[model samples]
Target: MSIAWDDALKVGNIEIDADHKELIGLVGDFETMVKSPKSVTPRSIQITLERLQLYAHDHFAREEYIQAIAKYPGLAENKRQHDALRKTLADYIAKFEAGQFGDLGKAADEMAAFLNHWLMSHIVDVDMKMRGALSDEGWR
Candidate 1:
């Protein structure tokens, strides 16, 4: 199944929803790069991973800030989830730098697949919860 972000996946707030859409697009792009017949070099993978890292960092901070302002009850859990993912992404970046993957192509493929699965699950299980919680607190 493709990792997608659609109108039905919206989580009430426009900014958060937009962030999710961009993140989904990024994941799809990374997966496409992995599946491409073109030579997937370590440099190329690093570039995309770096983009994802920066984007996720900003998105998570924005999201958590909103959640804090709205007094969303799930704010703590959201922070925990975001931090965990950040660590995972950082670990992958470190592994890439250390050339520990042996087969960069295979490692890139694995990370792409994991990102796809993780993004969708996170949207549904964690981020989506913010819709109701934010609404309860009269957040947009």
Candidate 2:
């Protein structure tokens, strides 16, 4: 199933929300390819997956930097979560390289699940707290 973008995914941060929207769109595209037998190709899926991985790293780095400048107290834990995701994605990429390209379907599904869980839980639960702290510090 494709993940739909909705207001529930927003964190009230304009820049981050825009990035999240784009990320969701990419995830949706991957889902579409996963279910389309005629469109599936190792090259295409690898490119998409690599793009997502690169963008994820860039997004996380930018977020961490912003959180740091904003004096978000939970930055450490948030950074840890970012690191964990990077590692997991790297592992998934390795699996693709090992003649498991057909696993794109499973990978896409798992990625969608992780994205939803992480966004809702981390953005709302943890990230919001950090944002509050940052605002309190008059950093934003």
Candidate 3:
């Protein structure tokens, strides 16, 4: 299943919301590549993962910076969650590089599910808090 970006994912912060939209688009691209007849390869998956990781790192930094500027109370927890996601991505990349997951299709499915869940939950539960704080400070 493809993950579509919609109003439900918006967090009221323009930069973060734009980043989230890009992230969702990247995931959609990954899904398409994985499900395509001639484009699904381990190398392609690795490249997609790299792109997602890079974007995620940048987005997290931006979000953290905003949180710091806004003095958001949930900054620490947000950092923790970001760290956990980074670790998870690193582990998955290592496993993929080591040929641990024999089935690319299954791995792709798992990755899509994990990313969709993480992004949605983080946006709703964690990011929205930052938005609230920023809005209160007239920063949003």
Could you give candidate 2's per-residue lDDT for residues 9-102 as a string of tens digits?
5655565666777777777777677677667667777787788888878878877877787766778998988887788778877877787645
lDDT of 1 by residue, 33-92 (tens): 888837588888888889989999999999998898888888899899998889988987
All candidates: TM-score: 0.89, 0.77, 0.89
Q: In candidate 1, where is summed lDDT lowest over 10 consecutive residues?
A: 131-140
What is the lDDT ranking, best to worst? 1, 3, 2
For candidate 2, the lDDT comes to 0.68
Cα RMSD of predicted structure 2 = 3.2
Clashing pairs in model 2, backbone N/Cα/C closer than 3 A: none
Give each model's whole-structure lDDT.
0.83, 0.68, 0.80
Better of 2 and 3 by lDDT: 3
Counting clashing residue pairs in each candidate, in order, gives 0, 0, 0
Alpha-carbon shift of residue 116 in model 3 (angstroms): 1.8
